[model samples]
Target chain A: MDLQYFAELFLGGLTRGSIYALIALGYTMVYGIIELINFAHGEIYMIGAFTGLIVATVLTFAGFPTLAVLVLASVAAVVYSSCYGYTMEKIAYKPLRGAPRLSALISAIGMSLFLQNYVLLAQTSDFLPFPSLVPDLPFWEPYAHIISSQEIVIISVTALVMILLNLLIKFTRMGKAMRATSQDREMAMLTGVDVNRVISLTFIIGSATAALGAVLIASHIGQINFYVGFIAGIKAFVAAVLGGIGSVPGAVVGALVLGWTESFFTGYISSDYEDVFAFIFLVVILIFKPSGILGRSETQKV
Target chain B: MASLIEIRKSFLVSIWFMFLTFPIMVIRVNTVENVIQWRWNNMIAVGLGSFLLSFVWRYLIRRKEQGVQRQEESTGLRRSIFQRIGEDRRIFLPGLTVAAVAVVVFPFLVSMYQVNIMTTAFMYIMLGLGLNIVVGVAGLLDLGYVAFYAVGAYTYALLNYHFGLSFWICLPIGAGLGAVFGILLGFPVLRLRGDYLAIVTLGFGEIIRLVLENWNEFSFGPSGIANIPRPGLFGVAFSLEAHSRYIYFIVVILAIFTIFMVNRLQNSRIGRAWLALREDEIACQAMGVDKTRTKLTAFALGATWAGLAGVVFAAKTTFINPASFTLWESINILCIVVLGGMGSITGVVLGALVLVLLPEYLRAFAEYRILTFGVVLVLMMVFRPGGIVSNVRRTYQFEGPDSGDK
Candidate 1:
């Protein structure tokens, strides 16, 4: 492959990976905290995009500047998504806390289906043309052939998010409580960690990340529909699993790896079979390395 | 008593929900034209609706808590009504007779349209029972059960398309192919944990569908194959109405056969192995259940039924397409198994009828059917995880000395 073409594909993979990482972070965090797949997590991301679209559409229509519109829309998406995540946990999952893992999973699937259809019922089912919110910087116009400024923004924002998240986890009391809860829920409660709040906070944070991803990707792609979440959700879940679910850093690495795989395979092989390749990759990985790249192998004790 | 704190709590909830629903519900965006349709009424409705619904929500939560507390307080396990009716021979015998009579006479009395719907319901009953083997009995959360169904459907469609094979011939072939596919999937996934298994299966299902959609020369792509003949009787061509009735009877017979086989399997050695596996995989393996064999059997058995149902589905519709078999269909089948009362035949039958028939009849709200299924699933999980007809555990009871072990 030519170097220029290879570089383009690499950046393309990075963009895709960054998006997957954004969503996979949610899955990893939630799985770390509760050990449930949080199947409806994708729906929250879709809702984020829809929310952002609506807010942006109205704000722009109301004569707001593009920058103000972008910031406000992202904020709205985050706030609404966090609200949804909190409510979803309280309504669907909290009651089933002591129930079998399967029950929580089924509920999550149900919640996912419910939210997808809810959006379908509330919004139009057709693909809505999302506005391109990222403006290209004049200075970076020369290298735009390889990577657009929008992509640059996405990568930088994702990096910024990761740094902020790392700092939060390392320094904040809530983050410490989250770590404690993830390690041992009962012990954390015994140590007066307010486990429920920690759980809610985890969901909220995860959903917020998903919302950010949704808004960014939606703007970049320039269109969205209710069905976007299911496929993207599954892909991110695959990334999460690939990185050995429940590990945050693993999620990023896994997403990037998956992104590269899809990008290169589609670039060289067949675009039609891109999804098939991803799934097959997942199945194969699961078969041989069930623990994932960064995940520790867990053993069950009776 | 109208409690002020409760009202205040509900009011806050209403406000939160109103805010939560504001953008999506209130603003209708037409991106094509840049026009915004602001429906202020939806927000008001949400506010009012949530305010009222929170009372019911709290009441249900309170009642659920009380019910759990009561169950804990009681030393003895209280049987559900379905279980009680099932165990009492006098009641069970009569109920069975009545149900049998209804099944026999209902087709004759109902319109052809109703028969068609009933046939579909029976088909779901079969699919649900098949899925029950993997999910309910074996504790494998398979989200790709429809892949096997698609395998069955496509097998029949392709066989008939190429060889002019009859339905009677394809039925077993379809089922066998489905079992083969199931085994193929089961072998790799047998070692994975429950959730991981679910995703892999989902991936597998999507892979199958995508291949079918893209591989035009192989499966004819998305336009689907049509004009496939229905099940024949002695090389005779039946009228469309007759075909519908014939399919109904065929489905009814197959559903009964499925019920019979599953019932027998329930107490069989392998069935018990599956049950043990569902309860605890480690314990089951430790008990020398041969986890791989039991899991594979469950997969094969489940897929076999799906295959049978798949052939019937293609024959009934006289068409097959990738769209017909989606993850949603798999979820629908899973819902039937779970909603019916996992591992309970009666429950599956009941669940099949309600889930299938309600949607069929409610044509106006048909659009909302899936949305309703989603809600039903959440509600069912929250309120009654065991399902509509919870399985009854067989227990040994000692009688008085005179009637000891009677």
Candidate 2:
């Protein structure tokens, strides 16, 4: 492939990877703490995107400044999705605490189905065009042909969020409590950490990040649908697992790898089997290294 | 934590929830007008409903605490009632016999439309029973079980379409292919367990569907193979109303056969090994159960029944498509097995009937049925993880004739 084409593909992959990274963070965080795949998380992201759409529409109609509109919509989306994340955990997952692993997983799946269909019933299933509210930055014109302003925004925003998240987890008290709880729940509780609060906080932050991702991705892709969550959720899950599921940085790296692989494969090969390639990669990775590239291999204690 | 009434805090949380839900639930885009519209009524309803839910939840918790004080008084009465049923055979055996007879004669008593619905329910029972072997008995959570059903269905469809094979001839062939595909998909993931296994199987299912959709020459792609021949006894075609009766009879027999085989397996050595594997993998391996062989057996056996159901399904519809076999179908069958009580034969039957019939009855609420199905799944898992009819573990006694104390 030519250099320009390859760079373009790389840029596309990076943008897509950032979106996946956003969703994968939620899965990894929830799994790290509870050891349960939060299957409904993707739905939270979808809901966030829709919320952002509505917020942006309202703000635009009110004739707000472009910058204010974007900022407010994003904030509104995050706040709304975080509440959904909290309510989801409270209603579907909280009651099943300490139950069999499968029971909780099943509950997550049920909640996922409930949310997806609920959205379908509440809103039109057809793809709705996302409002192009992103302001054009003059500095990006030189690289505009290779990388659009939107792509740069997605990438820069993702980097900022990841860095902030890293700082929050490392320096904050809630982060320490989350870390302690994930490592050993009972011990954390004994040490005066309210595990429940930590867990709820995890869901809130994880979901907020996902909402941020949804808004960025919806703007980038220019369309949104109710069923977007199912496939996107699964792929991000694949990214999480590929990067060693419980590790946060691993999720971001894995998502980038998945995105690049998909971009090149679609660019060079056929685009029809893009999803097939992603899933096949997941299965192959699972077979060779079930713990993932960066995951700590669990030793059977017997 | 110490307060009896935190009115301010509760009110704050409620208001916070109201704000969170307000944007998405209360306001929506009116596409024609291209403006955001307020759904104030929906906003108020949801806000009130959520507040009520929180209140009721606290009330239940309080009641549970108070009820604990009286539990000692009721324990004796509850124990006596349970023990009586445990020891009793007169009430159980006769009831089973009567229920069996009613099932056999049900089609004759019902109208054709009802029979058609009942037939569909029977197919689900077979699918649920088949999946029960993998998920319930063997303790492998297979999320791609519908793939096997698709294999069985396509096997029959292709055979009949290309080679003019009879349904009877194709039945066993489809089942054999189903087992082969089961083993094929089951092998790579044999080393994995729990969530990993579930995800891989899901991948395999998706791969199958994608291939079927893309490979136009072999499977006819999305348009699907139509006018597939039905299963017949000798040369008689079941293409009329009377033929519907025959189809119902065949389904009934197949369902019974599946239940019988599954029940037998549950009491056999294989069943014991599967149960052991489910409870603990390391312990079972240490005790001498061959892990790979046992798991493959469960997969192959489970796939066999799904294949059988697929053949029947193709015959009933007289058409086949990739759309007929989707992830939703797998979840539906899984729900039946779960709702009925995993590892419980009677529970599977009850689950199949209720899940299928309830949706059919609520025809007007068709779109809402799936929403309810999702709700039911979450509620069932949270409240009754064992299912509606939890299986009672049986113990055999090696006693002489005088041991018949009942």
Candidate 3:
């Protein structure tokens, strides 16, 4: 491809990858501490988008300013999704904390299915149009050939969130507690860290990030549905695993790689095989380097 | 079972339901008219249903607890009722004979619709038995097992569609292909453990489905291959009127063969190696069990049965599609194996019957069926992690105290 075409694909991929990275962070964080895939995390992202849509719709009807409406909608989405993440942990996961890994995995799958059907029964299964929250800026007209204002917003917002997350994990007390718990839950507990609270906080932050991702993706795609979570969740999970399951920066890098792969594969190859490419990548990675691109290989002692 | 305290618990449960149901169930987005829909009735109904169900469930548990207290006085009767049938060959022989006769007469006794459901259930039984070797016996979690079923179905479907092959001819081909694909998929994941192995298998499953869905030249794409030939006995066609009975008998035979094979394998040297591998992989390896060969054999054997089941399934349905072999179908088979008590053949059969037939009977609440499955899965795992008919540790006659003297 020519330079301009490549740039366009890159920009498009960056936006898509940003969303994947946000979702992957949730998977990585949960897996890091609890060693559970938390299969329902993707549903939280879907719920976040729906919550944002509702908030945006209500605000639009109320004739609020675009900036104010966007801010409120994002806040509402984050709040609602965090609630879902918290409740999911408390209800489905907490009881099976010390159970066998298979039981926990099964429970997570159950929760995923339950939430998917619950949403299906509550809302119509058909796709609903998501209200555009990106404010139209005439000044970006010159750059519109390469990247839209919406894409710019998505990329920048994701960058800012990642930076803030980095700061939180590095400089804050809660971050230390989280890291400690993930390293060794028993040790952390003995060292006076409230492990449960740390785990819950990890879920909250992870979920809030996913909500941000959902809102951004919904605005970009202009549509949402109940079943969207299943595929996106799986893809994001692939991205997470590709980056090293518990590594934060690895998730971002892995997601970007996946996004680029999907974009280019769709452009060059058949679009029908876009999802197939990601799954193929997962299998290849597992076979060649199962620790993932950025993850450390775990050694089990007999 | 009913008491004032029970009513209070039910009240608390209803309140919990109200919080959970109100937001999602009450305010719904209506896509058609572009408006929000108020589903107040559904919200209240669900909350009330949860309360009533939990109450009844609690009442049953209470009754069971009370029954246990009274069991001491009726110990003799209880002992007679639950006597060790496994130890007595005479009692077991008559029971087996009666069951065998009943199974042969089942299709004739039931309606055609029920017979058809039984056939489907038996197909799952065969699949469950196959998966039991890998997951239950080998302790390797395979999430993409439906891929084997797909391979088997498509083997028959394509052979029949292109060459006009008979079911009997294509059945072995399908099974052979299934085993080949199983080894192909299993080889790479031999070094991977547990969840990693599961995800890779799942990815492989998706890859197979994607290929079938997209490769129109080979597999007919999304439109799927239709009008596939059905299985027949000799020159006489098992036509529409006798369709259900013929398929039911065919599935019964296949299921029996699977059970017989798995039963034989479980006691053999390789089966012992698999059991040892499941208990402690390091020890099994130290004991000179070739991990690669044993695992591959487990995968191949498991896939072989799934292939046979798939051939029967394709012939019974007389059509094949990528949609029929989704990841959900794989999970359904996995659930049957796990629910039936992983290593137990009897448990697998019971699990398939209950799971498959229960959904068919609850067709009135079709939409709620999957939701119920989710609930049932979680409850089963929570209460009985070992499964419905958890495998009993085999006791060899040589291990008994008097064996040394003999």
Q: What count of clashes does model 3 give? A: 0
lDDT per residue (tens digit) for residues A42-101 in model 3: 889998888888778767767899999999999988988897898688667875676667
Give stretches of model 3 more than 4 Å off.
B1-20, B31-34, B39-91, B395-406
Q: Top lDDT: which candidate number?
A: 1
Better of 1 and 2 by lDDT: 1
Arranged by TM-score, best first: 1, 2, 3
Select the stronger candidate by TM-score from 1 and 2.
Answer: 1
Chain A: TM-score in each model: 0.97, 0.97, 0.97
Write candidate 2's Cα lDDT for B1-406 as tens digits: 5443655555666777678667766777864469666888876777777666667666665664565558655643323233345368987678768877987788778799988999999999999999999998999999899999999899899989888998888888878888998899879889887677887888888888877877899999989889997777887655577777888988998899999999999889999999999988999999999999999999999999999988888988998888988777887888888888888888889899998998899777889887887888887887677677777676565778887883
Off by over 4 Å in 1: B398-406
Kindly report which residue stretches of model 2 are placed more than 4 angstroms away from their true locations once superposed: B1-17, B59-88, B395-406
Candidate 2 backbone overlaps, count: 0
B274-306: candidate 3 lDDT, tens digit per residue: 999898888899999999999999999999998
lDDT of 1 by residue, B28-138 (tens): 999888789989999999999999999998999899999889989988767888878877999999999999899888888989989998999999999999999899888
Residue A289 in candidate 2, Cα distance off native in Å: 0.9
Top candidate by TM-score: 1
- When candidate 1 is compared with the true two-chain complex, its DockQ is 0.71
lDDT accuracy of residue B225 in candidate 2: 87
RMSD of each: 1.9, 3.3, 4.2
